[model samples]
Target: MKQTTVSERALVLAPRGRDAMVAAAMLAEGGIEAVVCDSLASLIDGLNAGAGFVLVTEEAVATADLRPLSDWLAGQQEWSDLPFVLLTSRGGGLERNPAAARHLEVLGNVTFLERPFHPTTLISLVRSALRGRRRQYEARARLIELRESETRYATLFQTMDEGFCIIRFVDGPHGPLSDYVHVQANPAYERHAGIPNVVGQYVRQMVPDEADGWVDLYRGVLTSGEPIRFERELIATGRHLELSAFRVEPRERSEVAVVFQDVTERKRAEIALRELNETLERRIEAAVAERQAAAEQLHEAQKLETIGQLTGGVAHDVNNLLTPITGALDLLHRRSADHDPRMARLIDGALQSAERARVLVSRLLGFARRQALETRATDICSLLTGVQDLVTSSIGPSISLRVECSQDLPPALIDPNQLELAILNLSVNARDAMLEGGILTIAASHVRVDALEVSGLAAGDYVRIVVSDTGTGMSAETLARAIEPFYSTKEVGKGTGLGLSMVHGLAGQLGGAFTLTSAPGQGTQASLYLPLAPGVAAANGLSSDSTLMEMEPLNILLADDEQLVRIGTAEMLRELGHVVHEAASGAQALNRLIAGEPIDLLITDYMMPGMNGAALAGRVGEINPDLPVLVITGYAGGDLDIGLPQLTKPFRQADLARSLYRLFHTGETLPTDCA
Candidate 1:
């Protein structure tokens, strides 16, 4: 405890008699605290705990082991150099005594005070040693502060997101400060520059061509001691870098620090946007015109779509009304049977007028695209030739007619009746156009077409039928709306606008196209392009015996929502010698079968109230899979794909006979001879 108190001042070690006590008294009188250590271990312990200087006698360590003291002295801190004042005997200095020299070597920072020396000399040496020890503590404080600052710098340099690098200018063969080498880099250096392991890379080796620009830019910052911020492209790596550079302190080292980010994509988008704006003014007018035209076409298309839907609904109702009228009229005509000549003539006129109504309804159905087209392979040249006489009569005596059909013209896949009607309509229009007497030409030819040549048809063989007349042609405005339903230029009663529309609708329904060309002064030409039928034309092989075949009575169920249609249809069926059971709706029709009624054939109107004909057919399939079902539809029956025979509404007894013959004899389509 005493030695620990004294260790901050001086430690006294003197094994010779009265020496230790004397040195202690001398240091105490000089206002210095001192502790007397009995052995070398105590002195070493005092040195470890804390001490300013050591006062020791040469005799104390002369015969004692000094390795412990030597070991303690060797292990001092960098800022520590413990001072020692040695008390040597007379003539026992380092030059004359080898042991004394060895002691001097082991105990460094020592001052020798010989025996019998003056008290003033001893105090002066001890005070000087204490002053030297105080300076070492100040040095230790400075070293600690320096290390902490370096640690903070290292942490920030490695953790920043911006790519950072330090480059030092180097003299090269080119000139002074011509090149630079990367001395340090952060973790983000590789990401921004796209170059890995770049800490030791030289500018010349990394990008030789770009080295001069980089060196010159950073060199300006280094020389001028001003921070520079700019963006530039690195040619070798193909990167655009937004960079900020500043000269580090002590510019003589010629080092610069840089922080950067990659800006390649942002720069490219900016360039593209600038280029688009430069040319936008030149294209605005044409773009608006095209958009206006598209809007008009779309408006016309939507109008046609709405009209087609309404027409289909109206056609369904009209067909239902026409059914009873035609049936009653035909029944009346047959019952009269020439009882009176005047009565037969009146009935015939009424029948012909009803027939015209039927034709008009069919044309409406065609325009609506709801007509069930019976497409077949027919020779187009023969079809054109067949229509020539009718065309000649319709044109009257003033206009001449010409039919020029090419030889070996291919058969087209189309509904022959619809094609005939379409050609007749075209001839009528031509006749009307040639009021002043002009030539009307109808030409038929086989033409091969690619996809781009036709608007609607794909690349294939087609039969083109062109009808032309030398007459007052239509203007561009009239030609544009020529195919729109209910649009006409003729006096109100002179023409129905649906003629061209029905032809156009038929072409679309049969997968074909109708085109017209006309000018104000020149004659008009109307062309119909029908696709060539696949393979060869199939013959309608109805047996001659089928013509003489008699139809046996069918135990039939007739279902209809309209009472008049059902009553008229049932009477006709009974007149044909078939017993008919009637139902008001599809549900009632289905209930008859479920109730075990004797029903050999089920004939139901396709559109009915509670359940539709297709739904009723599906239900009937579960009850009697083999029952021959005949579907009668006022609406379009083409969508009814249940593999049942269909008879369109307002059909005569002959049409009904033909449909029934097909169901009984063959599931495939039969010839019209059965009718």
Candidate 2:
């Protein structure tokens, strides 16, 4: 029920002027717009302009050659068929006249009225023809609207983002449908599925792997008359697709419409996220374990530091007490040289016992004190060879010893004596572990130490000394405290527990590190890392066997706060053929030097009541720049920089004699054995 604006008036064509006017007047009076034409040419023009109905006399239609009008009628639009009302004479017999009938046929939908008909009849016939013409115009409007709707639908189907395809099932040998063919596909279908030229192709032929299950899914939707949505991977294209299918009309033949989109990237991202989460969990577990281990190491270090502090305080007191005792023993031995033979034997025994005690005290002090290192370029291979015999004899013949030294190994910068002692201590410990006897291997090699490889050591070249024992190794509990002072695993009185602690101290003081590896059942391996020495020859210590030089007696100033120590030391110097002056304090010693007491040498104790020995030495240097001074101390604390000749306390007659000899010949070149 749509409306149209096309002309709804009647057009009249009559050669007879009167009849044409009459018909026009009648149509106008009957409420119809009418147009009258005087000739066939004018009537053709009127039809072209648009008219609801045509009024023409048979004479006008036949005599005028209506060919142009017939052609116009044949070319009419599908929705239009022009209506015509014809007026003819009653006795004309137009049906029998072929030419007249043919003319009449050209004007389609014609209504005939006789010439004698009443005016009311003519008007009614014209009205009927006009109504029919209006219906034709309405049909034309509906046809145009239908075409526009179809155009819009086609545009949407082709341009939508999701792929759309219509499939019709093909029948097989056993059933109504075995496969489906692509009946219609949009532009997006190829992009989403990575398949080109898909339309009009059967699903089985295009993607054979997917045909079996995919056809079944579509068939079920068609039979059940329900829609389905799911996801699948296309084997041919390697694409993940999200698909939705619904049954189309004519479902008995198994026709379906499908919409799909590619979701491969989304699926890949989900998997990557899951893997990242798993890796993060593993890293977190490792970090937690590292923190726990670090805490345990800190606790052990704190415990060892506390015990070292207590042991250091006790060792300092012992050194002080032994100073006077050893000094008196030296004096008695000298005086008892010609005593009874039995008394001389007793003296020899007592000196041996005191020497043993001194060695034990030195080990305790090594664990407690952070002493200055006298580092020198030492050939490690040669040093190890020198100690091999001593170490083998100490371990006994039950255990075999092997020394492996690499050729061209780098020299280590360390105190030779301390390193030798450390090696000896490690060898003894190895001997004790091998109750049933085992092989002890000592090896030396040149190695490069990276910064991260060792704690508290810089990246550089080092000499690595490894000691391996095929003996019962330590348990975890014992290994953890192996470097702690006085933490012995041996039975009471069997071990001092200071062996590894002293070695650890030596390594640290020399700017290196010590590492021990052991397990309950496996053998033990200990590595001593010493930094490579700057290129230089080895520094030798003063040799005890060096003969004393003959020298003229010189005036000497001997100063000490302790009366016993001062008197005892003065007597030893006097016995060594030197004039000795005594002073109880640094102030008293300075007074004698200021008064021009003819002092040839100044020997002062480091710790005195007023002004220490270093201060006295500095004052004496101002008075006599060339005066030689010797500083003696029982315990050399952290500050030992006196810039004077140093001699450790509790010395013998020979020790004083050697020191005096060196002082008199300070300007002369002495033998290297005095180093």
Candidate 3:
């Protein structure tokens, strides 16, 4: 294909009239752009102005010196020869124009034209010369453009922080891996590789081990025609570098260009950023968990507080009903015939149901902190031993119960009854776990704990009691939520799910800690840690103390906000053949005393809307210093902050009778267990 060429600009130097006009007209007709100049001065100016070609008459050359033009043409590069056409006679080619033709052989693509008898010949010569000149001009323009592009690329490569290298291949007869040369290296590459003047050098001498790899890479590209990019660690430079090599095509020479970059800093930055992100994520997750835990604790506390309010009222009302029922039962049993046992059975059934209700309410009150606690230093070993029989009785026949009481177990100050109830609850849970056959182990020991030994436990001596079961165990997820109230593994209606919660609450009330550990197929273990009690003796055995008989009556005053409770309680007192007076509020009860009612005893209900039981007791004591007062309420300590003798709600009639007799008989002295 013949490439179309745009015409070259020509300067027509026609100093003389006829020949100048003829050359300009002929060059123009041949598609050569021609500018006509009328004088030698103008022609010289045009040449100096960088005209592509010159068409000059012989007369103009003879007139002007033309020495400047000769010097300029002599300085032309090998590929740049400004064509100068001379207008002459037919033999003009043979004439030696010394100054004009000087260095013509040294210049490339230079041509000459003889002055013509025919305009066609002149036009043809001018066209040919201009075509050659145009080609030279286009080549020069391309070279300039190439040089400019190379300069721009060089600036980029040298200024960049990354390392860059170009590997060139020399083709050979044997499999294309013969010669490897480092053709070009940017400044960054030179600085990193610690080499200079590396261009056009064999890689074997410049980079020994890298040379073989370069040869292989070049061969691979030559054979497979595939570009490869890879990362490698430069142990010497302590940097990771990425190399990208590809065929610089026309694989006849099997040339490949390689670009390298130092990626060590980027890798380090990535590692650091990942670590930072992980740390931030962990911190955020921990913060969220802490907030959630705090919120759950707050919710639990509020729930317990609400339960306490409900149970306190329930205890008062239940205890009142129990008093009347028991009093009536005691009277009926005393008077009824042995043969007519239907009434007796009826009373017994009602009492049993009432007792069960009382027990349930007591459990509720304990959970809600509405139960009075009598904490005494008691050995956990004896406590565990005492609860063994109860545990065995509660478990299924197929389940086996085992007890291991530590010989030297430390004493823990706790309410024995409450602890027994917790043990029984745990035993029941164990029995339920093993429907077929399993072993339930109850053990007690003295553990000296240090801060380093446990994460959440304090450094001190603790009485450790463990309840382990060989029943089915829970998974990690289930174990995590086992301590939550109302959370249970038992089927609905079989368990209240409050047993363990009650145990936890009682442990907290007794200043102890409770923990459960379980895993799938590993069974479950619950550990209770109670603070060691000082200066207390262990109980002798696991026997309940006999109820006291033969009590003496004393003047008693009882006050309650609820009308039914006051009436029922009063009836019990009168039935017991003791003088009793009733009041609805603390103020009213005080009025009775001030009116010289000769009250020997005072009993007040706690958690009244106004002037609670404890505060009322304090006021009554102020009036009559010798009078002994018993503050009774479902709330463990009542709303009043004052310290006094307290009885938890839902107490049996017998318990009330026993308490009253003990208090009045002891006379003006608070019971040691009341606190």
Each model's lDDT: 0.83, 0.80, 0.71
User: In TM-score terms, which candidate is top?
Assistant: 2
Model 3, runs deviating above 4 Å:
1-166, 172-180, 193-263, 282-313, 326-360, 450-456, 475-493, 519-522, 538-557, 572-579, 586-602, 609-611, 614-629, 637-640, 649-675
For candidate 1, lDDT tens digit of each residue in 1-675? Answer: 221232447899998788899989999999999988998998888776688889998888788888989888888777778898988886546676666778888998888777789999999999899888777666766766777878887888888888899999889878998888899999899988899898777899899877888888998999999999999997777888899999989988889999998888888887788877766754776688788988998998888888888888888888898888888777777778668667777877887787777767777788888888777888777777677787777779999888899988777898776788898999889888878889989998988888788777778878899999998999999999999888988898999788998899889888889999999769899999888887666443223222322489999999999999999998878888899999999999888999999888999999997798888998999999888888998778344566777888876655666677778887565655554
Please write out the lDDT profile of model 2 over residues 259-327, one tens digit for every residue.
999998986787788888888888888888888888877886786677667766565456556666666
Which portions of model 1 show Cα errors greater than 4 Å? 1-292, 338-349, 535-549, 637-639, 666-675
By TM-score: ranked, best first: 2, 3, 1
Better candidate by TM-score, 1 or 2: 2
The alpha-carbon lDDT assigned to residue 366 of candidate 3 equals: 72
Off by over 4 Å in 2: 1-32, 37-44, 52-64, 82-178, 186-194, 211-235, 238-322, 337-369, 372-416, 431-437, 443-465, 472-520, 528-542, 545-645, 648-664, 669-675
Better model by lDDT: candidate 1 vs candidate 2: 1
For model 2, name the residue pairs that clash: 542-675
Q: Which residue pairs show collisions in model 1?
A: none
**lDDT, residue 6, model 1:** 27
TM-scores of the candidates are 0.56, 0.69, 0.63
